[model samples]
Target: MRAEVHAYVADAARLNRQPVLVLDPLTALDCSEAGYAEWFTEVTEGIEAHRALVVLKDKECEAESPRTTMMTVGVRNLRAAAPGAMVFLDATQLARKQDPPGVARTLATWSVKETAGVAINVGEHTPQAVADRYGIELRQTLAVTTGRRDLYVVADSSRGGVASADGCNPSDARIGSYEVLSDNPETTQHLWLTTPGISDGPCGSAPASKPGQFVPELATGLLAGTP
Candidate 1:
């Protein structure tokens, strides 16, 4: 289903004249666990094109936990690519040691400071818990398709979320402010996006050699628009 959907979307995007978002699988993998400064810098610099879609593989560890190359690296890269580009974070990519609730809060905090749109795909066991941590509600948005049940959620500081800290929480630092798309920043704005298969499948990055290839349902959910 994931592969089928991506192939269809990629093909559709091509025919419809949509911007092609690309990602470097190897780079994402390299930055997965610990911060690989060199790799992160190199990869972020490579995807500098405006409006380019960036995708990252959500690697799952042996124990079925999500693995993040480096939370900051991914967010940082998104900021660099397009300050307004939505950052679709696959919770499964986070390591086991990293608590989902904590990570979610950290992400919410980053959203407040960077002004970037962030939508996290959560699993059953941790969904509500994360929602509470960041004070975000999983509300339903207009149905994109009958086959999928898509919902929307907002991530802002009014919900007790804060931006990633420097000096103190260096690993989760934000480089600069991200431009706000919609919703008021003064309060928790119910931002828009879809979350169909939030806990749908095993998370992992696409093959390093072909990052552009379809990655199925793992973290395929779009930020604000299709393809």
Candidate 2:
């Protein structure tokens, strides 16, 4: 399983090495004007092909601040130049506790215009739900949980399912089918009976297999557990 995860991450890295543009709206206010100018030049110079531009698009900024104007101009320019680049405009900075409604709206708009993904950073943020409201692709992050001994599939909350959809997504998913796609074969327990889409099987009462010990039939059955 460890080997499999490493290989998967490696493949994903290789596939996404294309030139990218990152628009940051979070750091343009604090630093000195000269410091920002120099810092932007220094950072952008190193990654000319991988562009990173900072904008001061905070909703709270004065309408007259040069940084505010620059942010608007920069976003307009970026929209024209790299229309398809991955774009992220932080809205948290603009709202109460960084939960600005306008920021969420901005994220949804940019996500659609750029046809890209957005990350709503922490801070009681429910921005992803707002993204869903806009019909934007909103996939929640899934993390691997490891016991003192080893890594395993604890839960996947992306779907808001009863137990959350974990184990794997089905291959060749139909346009709107509710089938469990592919079972991730690497989780430590890999218990099929407890999974969301498979039927109960003999493994229902089977003890979780330890690290380095695999029982394919029991695992397969466990993963087949249905919602």
- TM-scores of all predicted structures: 0.34, 0.31
Question: Any runs in candidate 1 off by more than 4 Å, and if so which?
Answer: 1-35, 55-69, 81-84, 92-103, 106-115, 120-227
lDDT score at residue 108, model 2, on the 0-100 scale:
39
Q: 1-227, model 2: which lDDT tens digit per residue?
A: 22432343345456773332233433454344443444344333443333322222333433334444444443444454434333334332333343333444544333323322222321111223332332121221111111111111111112222221221222211111122213331321101112222222222233343322444543343334344
Error of 1 at 225 (Å): 26
Each prediction's whole-model lDDT (CA): 0.34, 0.31
29-56 per-residue lDDT for model 1 (tens digits): 3433343445555554543332333333
| Most accurate candidate by lDDT | 1
Model 2, which residues run further than 4 Å from truth? 1-15, 18-30, 51-85, 95-124, 134-227
